[model samples]
Target: MSRRKKTSPAEDVVDLIALLPWYVGVILALAGYLLLHRIAIAPLPSALGPGALGNAMVGTMGRGLATAGQYIVPIFCLAGAAISAWRRHARRSLMDNVARSDGPDILDDMSWREFEILVGEGFRLQGYQVAENFEAGPDDGIDLTLRKNGEKYLVQCKQWRAFKVGVPVVRELYGVMAAEGAAGGFVVTSGRFTPEAEAFASGRNLRLLDGPQLHRLLKQARGSSSAKPAADIRATEQASNAAPQAAKTAAPSCPRCAQPMVRRTARKGVNAGQEFWGCSSYPRCRGTA
Candidate 1:
């Protein structure tokens, strides 16, 4: 059995903290006030009379804490409002494409994060409520879980540029579908699929989308975003931000599907160690340069 890598607790704590919005501070402050009053300030008040005892060390500390807690409310409210506004702004910035139905070839010049956004946008266009699992690691392959018509659907995005996706990948997705009891499943790729993979999906409740089909889906999505021609994509990216080193390298495309090819080495046979560009749609498309 393989050992699972343990997640770092510190990282988990940081992620948890990030999810707690600023509004929570109000409740925390209120709780602090109650605690301070009970511990040091309440005894004197419960005696039902003003007295010199209120000047005691514990009493002073409690009074100070209680006073500080009073300010926490207004401070929390202001901070919460500001944080809420900033969150809305950041969320809107990232989801700018979610409301648009047309755009460029998403896969052509996108990072993995962008690919997930594109997938969610596509499903949203179809009226499905999308739930993303972008943070899932190798242990969890679910990328997008969608719901509509009282049925659940699981989608996996594979922005593979090289080698046609093979049958095993499709099979694994099928297993996930079964485990989730999903009504159906979709395996979307920026390239194509192998023949064996296609054959396995022939009679199943699974939809396999190759690059070209995915392109059309984006174009026809209801909200209709304006499509940016492929050439403009790179230019737009350049104008918007500095391109990364990886982006500078123009990877070769798969001749069969016109999808980007990934470098691979032969693992068996005489060509085993040779590096070459394989069709990202692997077993489905054996197209090679």
Candidate 2:
């Protein structure tokens, strides 16, 4: 995965803190309205008959109590909501950190049990009911089973890095899906897949989420409750990977610089079927192949 600066959970908490003032303002507004209403409704007789002064004094005291309640109640409500929002943000931030960290570098930082916990939390955030370290039965490659929408999904998570996932891994997942009659399967890895491995997965009812894809998933989970445009993220990743091929095809060769010439397969009228190769150094080298 391409390296990027990490976002901390403490930073997330700080963001939530910035929104607290708006919540406080809303609560204060409601409290002010209730306090005004209580004061307006407190009884005061137009004609000051005997004992009327005493009754008016008592009514003032009742209004004071009501005003205090108005202020205190809304303060409590705003505080509770702010706390809940902050906690949710913190949880999501921590999950994002786990998903984006370089697996090989961080693997040594966590014990096996902690690694399992992180994986389980990731699935749970995606609304899956996960069974961690599930037994591997014969022909079953599942390390975790997650059920959602009444369909069971067998998942195999590989924490391995510095390696590429290959065809046999996919083949085992296929066998497990067949044996358990799972609706579909997901293979999540902190590393990438070999081209052959990706080819093997294409026709099967399986989903492969590689390291970058996994980071994107965690980022989406951290998003607010709204649909996001996934196209941009996919496009960016594709463009980054395609840059070398694009560069090779666009430039002419410079013997000193070792850059290839711009080449085009079609150049002129009907029969001009191909075009390629002119040295970037041109007159100096006059090289063509």
Candidate 3:
């Protein structure tokens, strides 16, 4: 899958907004401290005159308050920054957790909400207009629809964890694309795709985004706010294009590991007549097909 660079304004806003509470707390604390210090020392006599002892006491108190502010301000700033950064980090971490969760039975486990976000972010990066959580029909299979440069694209989010996304899913998506008259279709999954699924997608307008592709999308989404140099974009494009067509043409190996040349046939099915490649050591290997 080609990685697209698109910044998420929402995420950036969230990050910046998350710091507000900490900033407010620090300001309030500092103001209260300064106010209390002023009120406590404002009545003190000047120059340590007749009441030299009282003057000295007040002077000491003033010095202590000053010393406290000096120590407290820096500590508060550091604490505030750390807490703000952590809150932002935690939100990202939570999203990551949702993305990486093991789908139940490798077909129905993906958190739909997370998958929608991923698709929306992917389209945004690609400069496409993406509509999230779109409901076409009960069996429509499309979670999102994207439009770019006058071409319509349909998207299906399969948040599977273990089992490879098989040809059936792709076939269903293809049917949806035809019905919708879409220019292309995308099947984005947190899990891997089976060789049959990959093969089915080949020579078709359908594109598959597996786990690694999803990771790349996440990285791009996170990095979009920062502009990438032209040189960097060129280098990435070159690297992507430089990969051997053979490598790209190869069938899905182990979804767990993208090792190609692993094919097999099911013991029984209408597809039992068909051949597929799985991880060399399956069951125990628990690898993709």
Candidate 4:
């Protein structure tokens, strides 16, 4: 397939507008054409003095520009609306693919841009308004911005082949979240996080999702009821805030080292489909419950 070409300044404006609802672009297109057409056709005042010559010339220039812009601006807006409609369709198609798939392996084969789109679609299915990052910049670390319950949340996606996300990645997201005053943040990977990364995220309102967790989240979201009211998101936040404490009180201790165990699902071997508690100090202590 052919790759998309680099966008020009005018195309960039169209894309930025495309990020809004598709109908909004259509409305802007209509409004822009009408306003510019009015300006283009307005009658020029008769020059009464020598100084009025410059004003007439300026008005003539304005009308000339407006004459062309009446068409040009609306074309740009309409193009944006077309792009917005295409993206909405793509997102829905992406979600449908995931819903039909059997496992998370489908995610591993996708390009980074496709992965980001999939992630954004997954969030949208969960009732969040998701905005994608189309360009790179200093704060472009955020792959997706999600809004629900009038609260902002940032997300950073790692489609890493290395299969292990570390503390520094989580730390950077936390710093950005703090700087931006986001309600929370999520670090999602098509792989697993290092123990230190998980430790740092605890109680920070930063949810970390490794491969399996993300798969389950998307699957559940697809199966769940359509986007709930804003109050549902708030209730989810309350439940998430209370989860750590509940886990602390309820988790079983490791049989070998006495450390707390984390609930984990078996991915291979005789117990491939089972859920069990495994030692948090894994690799060092191979205890299970």
Estimate the TM-score of every prediction.
0.49, 0.41, 0.42, 0.72
Candidate 2 C-alpha error for residue 59, in Å:
69
| Ten-residue stretch with the least lDDT total in model 3 | 1-10
Candidate that would win on lDDT: 4
lDDT tens digits by residue: candidate 1, 201-221: 999999999877887776566
Q: TM-score of the candidate numbered 3?
A: 0.42
Best by TM-score: 4
The candidate, 3 or 4, that scores higher on TM-score is 4
- Tens-digit lDDT string for candidate 4 (127-170): 89998876634444688899999999999999975669999999
How far is each candidate from the true structure, as Cα RMSD in Å? 24.4, 17.0, 23.3, 19.2
Checking candidate 2 for backbone clashes, the offending pairs are 251-261, 251-262, 252-260, 252-261, 252-262, 253-260, 253-261, 253-280
Stretches of candidate 2 exceeding 4 Å from the true structure:
1-96, 99-113, 134-139, 225-289
Candidate 2 lDDT by residue in tens digits, 160-199: 6678888898888988898888999888777789898799
Q: Relative to the unseen true structure, what is the C-alpha lDDT of residue 57 in candidate 3, on a scale of 0 to 100?
A: 83
Q: Which regions in candidate 1 have their CA more than 4 angstroms from the true location?
A: 1-106, 134-136, 222-289
Query: For model 1, what is the error of residue 285's alpha carbon versus the real structure, in angstroms, after optimal superposition?
Result: 80
Backbone clash tally (model 4): 0
